[model samples]
Target: MNGETLQLEIKDNIACITLNCPETLNALSMRSLIDFHASLKQVIASHEVRALLITGTGRGFSSGVDLTAPRPGLNPDDPDELLRDYFAPTYQLLKDLRIPTVAAVNGVCAGAGVSLALSCDIVLAARSAYFVQAFVNLGLVPDTGASWLVTQAVGSARATGLMLLGEKLAAETAADWGLIWKCVDDDKLMQEASAIVNKLAVGPTTTYSLIKRLMRDAKNNSLRDQILLENECQSLARKTEDNAEARKAFAEKRKPVYNGR
Candidate 1:
């Protein structure tokens, strides 16, 4: 699926979603968010896609919402409407996707952009890229799940500082603070992200899906409940064809080939 502000391409079982509006540093307008939500639905409905990667063209991953962009019938002055109608659903779709999701941050990720990147299962950023909580600068508080996502990754203290100060957080520092999976050189960012996505695409995708669910549920579950959930998930994983193939391959002393069943 493709649109003016976004592009979606699937190849070798991996789906790549690119933010195409580079002129404004890939700042997402209402139209772009609509396109993005549609593209994600396409990915979810496709059986051929096993892994998903999100990135952007030219310079940045995304600079967040374009407050000045026009959307018919929507009140621009009321941020609540936009968040309820667009941003909330999009982020929920991403979080609930059955397949693994990766984000490649190529440049500046500010405001909601930071939440978008951090929402993925794994996030990799270019060494030169940085994140900023730009909302405070506009006299607004962080929205689009930033308040929760940031606080969950880093501690409350760091998240508070970032949001209140609206200072740039370097990619390397983000990694060190456990906000992202890794930070690579600018030229190698795509390469690393592609490598990770490709690996995930060919692995036991059913297991990955279960793992993703378990991790998300773990945040709110007590240790006793989490253990039960893991046991249940493991039972499900063990019933997949890929698990049988893995056992057979182990006995044969050869690498297992997964069909992502």
Candidate 2:
């Protein structure tokens, strides 16, 4: 949390994480990745955190891994092993984070950076922002869960094209391709992402967690099983005070104040 590579701050049940390595275009370094993962786990375990927002501190969100950093391991010759563990934590933390996460991409997101943005529950990119899979250009394959996450978001064919061609997809084009949630003005990205996080922070916490789990499991669940799972979730949700307040507010023709119960 005290590292200069990243900054983490919590307020109003929302944790904001900013990747801070502007000189290197906020490139993902090993130490930074480890610190970020630790910080995320801390926030997720804390009872006060309800939502998370991740962004960058410079012009670009990130240029992907910091190639200048020293490779780890006894075999100083094995670059493959080093690359495998480089951004491993970044990918794992995103997938394991229980709280709803949002990515506010303000600029260029290349290589593993695209995967990082895609890992978030919702990705809000600025008009000036662009996504690129520069791995092929560098004579490397996609890492940090990019291969799966990218294909999952935009399908296998598009993912293949993006990775192989190393094309830079603009924010609007990425949105059109269903690669990101939405695109806004250069200056409004953070504001819009903040509003979304505020909404989730005050909404149904338990139901949101359940819905996240259900959706992830949907990839493997049969239709009948999914229906049953939904039934169970709904049955549980209906008993919460937030649900009761919703019904009361509807009957009274007023807005409900959810406590995220």
Candidate 3:
């Protein structure tokens, strides 16, 4: 499926969403956000999709929101309504997806684009790709969950520095700081991402969903509560058909072929 600013394609149970506005470095205009939300809904409704990959075309993942684009019904000075109405819902949907998500960041990722990449379950960036919190440069603060995402990945000190300084962070440095999952050669970015996503697509879907929930809730939960949550998730995972297949395969000394049950 294709939208005005985005393209969605599903092959082999993997759904790929590409930001297609390369002319503006794939900037997220209002239209793009609307299309993104719609595409996510389509992914959710399509039971065939087991994994999702997000990336951009041309030289950048995204240059963040299209500041140059005209906002018809929004205040020119304030972006409050624009973010709440257009950006937040799409971001929330991405975060709440049951399937695994991978981000292939090819080039510049700035402002809300940084947040978008970080929202994925795994973020793999090209060697040449760089991230920047450009909000400070524009005299604005980080939005689209940038503040929370960055701080969660790195600690408060580094997040503060990155956001306040608004400096370019190389993909390697980002990986070193644990801000992203990995950094690959520029030419291998998509290849590496696809390999991981393909593995996830065929793996135990229920277990993966449970893992995502556990990790997402871990930081907020106390140790006792976290353990209880893990116990609950493990109980659910143990009941899945994939778990039984895995056990049978182990006993037979063969690799398990999961049906994503």
Give per-model TM-scores.
0.98, 0.92, 0.98
Task: Name the top lDDT candidate.
Answer: 3
All models: lDDT?
A: 0.94, 0.86, 0.95
Question: Which pairs of residues collide in model 3?
Answer: none
**lDDT string, candidate 1, 59-131, tens digits:** 8999999877788788868858888889989998998998999999999999989988988999999999999
User: Candidate 3: lDDT over CA atoms?
Assistant: 0.95
Range of the 10 consecutive residues with the lowest summed lDDT in candidate 1: 70-79
lDDT of 3 by residue, 1-261 (tens): 889999999999999999999999999988899889999999999989999999999999999989987677777678588899889988989999999999999999999899899989999999999999999999998999999999999999999999999999999999999999999999999999999999999999989999999999998999999999999999999999999999999999999999889
Cα lDDT, model 2, residue 141: 89
Residue 257 local lDDT, model 2 = 85
Of 1 and 2, which scores higher on TM-score? 1
Give every collision pair in model 1. none
Give the 10-residue window scoring lowest on summed lDDT in candidate 3: 70-79
Give the candidate order by descending TM-score. Answer: 1, 3, 2
TM-score of 1: 0.98
